[model samples]
Target: MYDFLIIGQGVAGSLLAWELAKAGKSVFVIDKGNPYSTSNVASGIVNPITGKRFVKSWLMDEIQPFSLKCYREIEHDLNVNFLSELSVYHVLNSVQEINDWSAKAATFHYEKYLSTSEIHYLDKEKVRNPNGCFEINGALKISASNFLSAIKNWLEAKYCYSEEVFEEAALNESRDFVEYKNVRAEKAIFATGYDEFFLKKHSNVKFSPVKGEGLVVEISDFFSENIVQGNVMISPTMAKGIYYVGSTYEWNFRDELPTESRKSELIERLKDTINCNFKVLEHVAGIRPASADRRPILGFFPNSRIGIFNGMGTKGFSLSPYFAKHFCDSLVAGKALLPEVDLKRFF
Candidate 1:
């Protein structure tokens, strides 16, 4: 019998399992291996400066350090390098936006990490972004696939993984433990991506899934180690001269397949922003299990043998480690959860 049975091996489950095992708890995970699992296709850019107004990320000081520490520890454990400290250059479009950024810079001392420095020597042939845009300091690129695989492999080594779709019929809950198939655990944690809709029986948990589309492009020029952010973001790939460019967040769509409309929109934006040409290497889409409030939802079910750790939204890379460790602590130690992100908000 395991101490925990985790459904879905996406970022949420993977990181939570890692935290639980680190704390010496037995954990089991089940995944159906969806390639477009939000974690797999995510650009995994942990940006501290976010949104149209460029406000600081939620709890940047606390979450950033904790997540960096976790990723570094896992890197050593897995013998893989997946995290990179990269600056994000946020392009300023208008005088008003520029002023807003400058005001935040002064008010928050954003100059410490953000700046208006000009980037020199981009491969002028492949990319289309205009030159000399203002830059921000806080961005980290993570190889989401590599990091997820590392944790998955670790779970496999412990003989605690099932590569099958989780069926409701397989679950059995008692006052204390929940059982699925032969695996029994004190509690079950669901991190099932957009399928969180399946948990609506609880009534309090609400998931506002957003469909996001991305493109993997091969560009012979305009390569940089720093991440570029404007309307969308461009993260460098492991292979030379390739980049993952994307992401259009559409709240009205439920389809996870890439659409021609989104493709055209993204292509047009990229061309207008960069002023260059590149070949599209791939098109991918996933529905992020974003919550209505835009913060993660973590809490236990009332009068039930279960807990949940999900609703990471697009900032999964920034939010997962902090919440995973927090959830593990709460599970094992009966700790108090932060009220802002706790499911108590919905309650």
Candidate 2:
């Protein structure tokens, strides 16, 4: 019998399983192996400051350190190289915007993450920066696709991973244990990303999923050492002269397929961001499981051994590692989760 039967090998499940397995708990992970899953295509840009007002991201002060440590540990454990410490530059539209950033930079709380900055690594001919861009310190650009693949390979080698769809109706649970097919476990965790079919089984929990589309482009003249937030983000991938640019967040999307209209739309925005020659290699789309409240959900359903550790949203790379440890440690110690992120909020 395994200690965990985790559904989905996305970041949420992958990190949680890592935490459990490292703590001497046996875990079995099942995934559909969809390359287009939201986790696979996400740019994995951990920006400390975002938006026009230049306000700090929620929980950046608390989660960044913990998550970084966890990711480095995962790198060592899995024998993979994917993490890269980098900066993020946000375009300030006017003198007022730059002043706002300058004011925020001098504050005590924002000192480490944001400093009075200037444009760097951008070409005057390539990018139209009239007011000059402010740099964001403590930003990260992780190769999430490579990281996810490596984690799965490690899990497969340990005989704890499978590429298959998990049928919710087949799950069997009693007072003391949960059983799925021939595998028995003390508990189960649903870390599936934006899975409507599976989430429908539990109507009590509410999930607000958002569809986003991005592009993989090869650019020769323009070079971005870090992620640049403009009309969209032009982030550096591991490969030379290749960048991941995107995305349009559609609150209501018909399906997860890439449409020609959106493709044309992204190309136009890409042109607006850079004044250089580029080739669009691929267009990708995925629906992310975001909560209406915009906070991650964690905890168990009442009167059941099954639990959930999902809703990391766009910040999964920075949120999952720390929260996964928090969830696992809480479970082992029989403690309660934070009221804000606790599942009872939706219940």
Candidate 3:
């Protein structure tokens, strides 16, 4: 029997599998290969401070370093470069907002992530920074699709990956283990993003799906190594002269399809942020597997052999590595999970 069977090869599952493999446990991963999945379309931006209030992301200190370490190790293992460390410039909208940032910069906790120096406008003619901006340290722009692809390749080489849909009807459970199709494992983990069919079995954990849309644009004379964040975020990709500009969060949506309305909204915001000549190259959308309390849902079923690791949400790139290590330890070494993220609270 295998140590674990992980369903879905998104960020959570891939990282968990990596951790388990590092612990010398046999693992198998199954993925459906959704081209427009959130991980595929995500800008993969990891920032310590976020939101209009510019508060530091939860557990940034602990999670950020772990995530970087994991990604660097993966890069060495896969012999590919997908992680880019970049500075993020938060465009200040008003004098009051600048004052708020300054006030927050004075705090000891915020000082590490917040920059107190005068913000530099890379292109004064092309970019708009009327009230200037603040620089955030230790931000990352990961190529999530490439990272997942590398992990999938690694799993395939080990003969532990299958590109197929996971059917709930195929799962068989017993006291010692669970069996699915021809594969039997001591435990099963469902890391599928926003797919409620299997998750419905755990009625206590509520998932809130948010459909987000992003766009790729080709800009001329916009040269900056740093990511720009205003009303919208514009991130540089590996492709020369092309930038990923996004994104709109629509809580109520019909499906995970790109909408012209959001496209126009993004373009308007982009134009407001910069005066560079640009054309839309691509538009994509995906649903985020968020939670009601905005924390990850992770734990085993109360009376079954199955477990779940979901709800990394918009912060998946930043949250997955650390939590995956934690979950893996809990699974393999009988460690206690963090009380905040434990699914027992929902139950």
Candidate 4:
């Protein structure tokens, strides 16, 4: 019998499995192999400062360091280069914005992350930055696709991974363990991203699914070492001259398919950000399992063997590692989860 049976091999499940294995727990991971799953299509940008207001991300102090440590350790273990440390430059359109950033930079908390020097324009021939920009250090552009693929290979070699859809009907729960398709585990945790169909039976977690679209484009004569965020964000990829540009957040969407409208919108925004010529290489879309409260959904069902760890949303890259460690400790050492992230609030 395995110590844990985890459903879904997205970011959440993959990280949780790694943590559990480190704790000397036997784990079995089931992945449906959905190509369009959020993790598969995620740009994997971990920004300490986010949104238009330039507010620091939640738990940035703790999450940023822990996430970097986790990814670096995994990179060493897997012998893969999936994590790229990059600086994020946010456009300062007006004098007031620049002054606001300057004021914030003087503060002890924001000093380290915010750049004190002003950058008028990244590339005068490419990007249009009128009033200059402020920098956020310790940003990361993680290649989630490559990382997951590496994890899958490792798990397969250990005979702990399967690529199959999980059916609730196949799950058998006993007093001490849960069994699925002849595989028994002491407990089961669902980290199934936006596929929360089974959540209805376990808890009253409500998900506000947000469909996000992004584009891969080839830009000519555009060279940058840092991520540029103006009207849109342009992040460097592994391929030369190719950048990942996106993304549009839409709450009302019929399906997860990429829309021509969003593509056009993104291109227009890209054009507004850059003056260089570009060609669209690909357009992708996925649904984010954002919670109603905009925090992660974690913890177990009352008096049951089932548990959940989902709803990292757009901040998945920044949030997953820290919480995965937290949840793992809670599971293995009887430690209590943080009250803010505990699902009891929703209950």
Candidate 5:
């Protein structure tokens, strides 16, 4: 019997297993092994500031450093390089935005994350930086595809990972433990990302899962190590001259499979964002398990051994590491999770 049975191997589940293992708990992680999952195809841009108003992300001050440290530790253990410090250039639309950015950057709290010196026009031959742009410090990029694959390989080495869909019908739960296919564990946690059917059926938790579409593009004239945030996110991939782009977040979507309209929309945005021509390399989509409250949900359903860790959404990259440790602490030491993220918020 394992100490824990983890369903899913996205960033959430993988990190949960990693943290639990660190706390001396044995884990068996099961995954459907879909490479096109949000965690794998995501641009993985851990931006400190976001949104139309350019407000700071939730708890970015604490999450950023902690996540960087955690990813570094993971790299050391796995002998892989997947995390890197990168500047994010937030494109300015007009002179008014430039002034607003300058004011925000001048503030003492925002100063640490936003840079005032780098506000300048990009090469006109490459990106369409008409009104120039300002740089954001403390931004990071996670080599998501490689990172997830490495973690899976590491888990497999310990004989703790399986590439298969979790079957709920085969699960058996007791007062203090759960058994799935004859494998028993003290608790079973669902870190299933956007596939949060368990939480929906069992609890009063409200999910506002958003469908996202993305594109892989090849811009021959564009070359930058930094992330460009404008109409569309132009993030560099591992391959030269190729980038991860688009990622239109639709609150309403027909299905997870990409639509032709979104594909054309992203291409149009790409053309408007950059001056150089780009060839569409690929189109992809994934549903992010965001909650209505926009907070992560983590806890056991009342009087049950089944627990859930879901609703990380687009910010999963920056949000998962510290919260994984938080969950581990709560489970191993009986520490309490913050109310905002706890399932108590719902029921």
Candidate 6:
């Protein structure tokens, strides 16, 4: 019998599997091959600076280093370049905004990341911006597809992955073990994304889903080496001549299908930022499994023979590695968990 059986192959599942397997624990992953899952479409932009005030990221100091070490080690093991060190230019929208950024740069601990030099990539003549741009440090762009692909290959090499959908009927749970199909494991973990239809079974934990929509635009004239941010962000993808521009956060609607109104909204915003001819390559949408509080939902089920490691939310790429290790240590070595992120948040 294996040590654990994991449901879903998104970032949460992938990272937990990596941590458990690397620790010599037997693990298996089951997924439905849903390309539209949130993990695949995520721009994987892990920024240490965000929002209107330009404050430091939530727990920036510890999370970034852990992510760097983990992704680098995984890169070596998988022989893939998935992480790129990149700076984001927080395009100040107005003179007042620029002044606010300048003041924040003076006292803000992350001042080293902010820059006043004019960006060379942007067209100075066409864009309608009187105020200059300021750059910030502490941003890393991760390619979700690349990272997930590497994890899948590693798991498949051990014969621990299946592309079939997971049915609740297939799961047999006891006080200490879970049986599924031909495999029996001492424990089971659920790491599914916004598809938390099974979460009702463990009603103690609370998860709020947020719908996010992004657009892919192909432009010949607009060229930038750094992530551009103002109302929306334009992050570079590995695909040539293409960039992922997004996103809109909607709390009311949580559907995977792209809406025409959302698409139009994104296109109009894109036109306001870049003065260039471009084509709308694709429109993608997904629901994020954001918790009521910002921290992740990491703990065991309340009444049954199962566990869950989920709720990475918008910070999935940055938070997954650190917490995956934490959860695995708690399981394998009887380690204590931080009170803030512990599953007891709901209680």
Which segments of model 3 are wrong by more than 4 Å?
Answer: none
Which pairs clash in model 2?
none
The sequence of per-residue lDDT tens digits that candidate 6 reaches over residues 1-347 is: 89999998988899999999889899988888788789998889888877777778877778888888888899998899888888787666777777777677776466556644443234555343446467777688888889888888888999999889898898998877899998799988888877657767656677777888999889876666678885678888877778999998888884678899999999888777777788999899988888878788887756755877888888888889899999999989999888777887776
lDDT string, candidate 2, 154-234, tens digits: 899999888888888889998889999988999998998788886788767777888888999998777878887767789
Per-residue error (Å), model 2, residue 70: 1.2
Query: What lDDT score goes with residue 244 in model 4?
Result: 91
Q: Candidate 1 residues 2-42, lDDT tens each?
A: 88889989988999999999899989999998777788999
Worst 10 residues of 3 by lDDT: 115-124
lDDT of 5 by residue, 199-280 (tens): 5575478888898999998997679898888889898887889989967989987778889999999999888888887888
User: Please, what are the lDDT tens digits per residue for candidate 4 over residues 295-340?
Assistant: 9988887788988899898888889999999999999999998888
RMSD of every prediction: 2.1, 1.4, 1.1, 1.3, 1.3, 2.0
- In order, candidate lDDTs are 0.81, 0.84, 0.89, 0.88, 0.87, 0.82
Ranking 1 against 2 by lDDT, winner: 2
Query: Worst 10-residue stretch by lDDT in candidate 5?
Result: 195-204
State every prediction's TM-score relative to the real structure: 0.94, 0.96, 0.98, 0.97, 0.97, 0.94
Query: Which ranges of candidate 6 are over 4 A from the true structure?
Result: 115-121, 126-128
- Candidate 4: give its CA RMSD in angstroms: 1.3
State each candidate's clash count: 6, 0, 0, 0, 0, 2
- Candidate 2 Cα errors over 4 Å, as ranges: 117-121
The model with the greater TM-score, 2 or 6, is 2
Give the lowest summed-lDDT range of ten residues in model 4.
195-204
Tens digits of lDDT, candidate 3, 1-347 = 89999999999999999999999999999999887788889999889999888889999999889989999999998899899999898888888888878888888988778756565555568878877778888999898778989999999999999999788899899999999999999999999988867657666788788899999999998877789998889999988888999989989999888999999999999999999899999999999999888999889878978989999989989999999999989988999999989988887
Question: Which candidate would rank higher by lDDT, 5 or 6?
Answer: 5
Off by over 4 Å in 5: none
Instruction: Flag clash pairs in model 6.
Output: 113-136, 113-137
